[model samples]
Target: MKTLYIVRHAKSSWKYSGINDIDRPLKKRGIKDAHLMSKVLNKMVDKPDVFISSSANRALHTAVIFCENFGFPHFNLQIKRQLYSFSDGYLVKTVNALDDGFNSAIIFSHDHGINTFVNEFGNRPIAHVTTCGIIGLKFKEKHWKNIRRGETFLVEFPKNHK
Candidate 1:
């Protein structure tokens, strides 16, 4: 069995002048929410073996907070450019290429793709995946290549708690 944790980057700040969308930093609320969600994840499951994130600054920052709070110091995170503004097909391909040695992995990226990826694999329609939202999926397959639609055993989001 394998597990995939899909997380959308925390809320980003548009308050900064002349900041590109890809370089936008997390808002104050985003930081707070990241910490909260990290705590929730620590209580729910063991730390993931791999952390993958989009190259975007917001996504990278969110992944950092999750790693710090979970005491997962090993930064084997890969910044996938394809994940920057890709569709669900690209996201799925990225996941399917993960190393089989990793029993669990975490992916931090943007919306739409994250939302669609989780919904497709989990066999459920997810509304907006708010900033800092998380969707945990348990798959029966050992390799990412074997993951298919309706193979997920769990799906969750941070908003569900509040």
Candidate 2:
């Protein structure tokens, strides 16, 4: 079985006027939500074999929080620039290319892409995946490249917990 965890980046700050979308840092509330969700997941699930994130600032920062909570090495986290794309095509490509050696992986990315990917890949239909939300899927397929629709084992969001 292969487990995949998809996380939408925490809320980002728009306070900075000239910053690019990829450079937008998390707001204070975003930081708090990341911490809370990370800690919560730490208790609920096993640490993933791989952690991947969009090179975007918000996504990377959110991934960092979860890494710390899980006691995973910061250097082990993989950052992919292609994951920054808003299209689910990139997300699908990134996941389909995952190493078969790893049984589980977590990916931190943006909205529309995250939402679209989950709806396509997960058995449960999710209308939306809010900021700091997490969805855990378990695939029966042994290889990532061969994965089809899988079971949604978990769904966690900041609002539901708060």
Best by lDDT: 2
Q: In candidate 2, what are the lDDT values of residues 1-162, reduced to their tens digit?
A: 999999999999999999899999999999999999999998999999999999999999999999999999999999999999998998889889999999999999999999998999999999999999999999999999999999999999998888
- Residue 124 in candidate 1 has what lDDT? 65
Candidate 2 least-lDDT 10 residues = 87-96
Residues 39-97 of candidate 1 have per-residue lDDT tens digits of 88889889898988898999999989998898877456677878887578778988999
Please list the C-alpha lDDT of all candidates, in the order they appear. Answer: 0.84, 0.95
lDDT comparing candidate 1 with the true structure:
0.84
TM-score of every model versus the real structure: 0.91, 0.98
Candidate 2: C-alpha RMSD after superposition: 0.6
Candidate 1 ranges beyond 4 A from true positions: 151-155, 160-162
Judged by TM-score, which candidate is best? Answer: 2
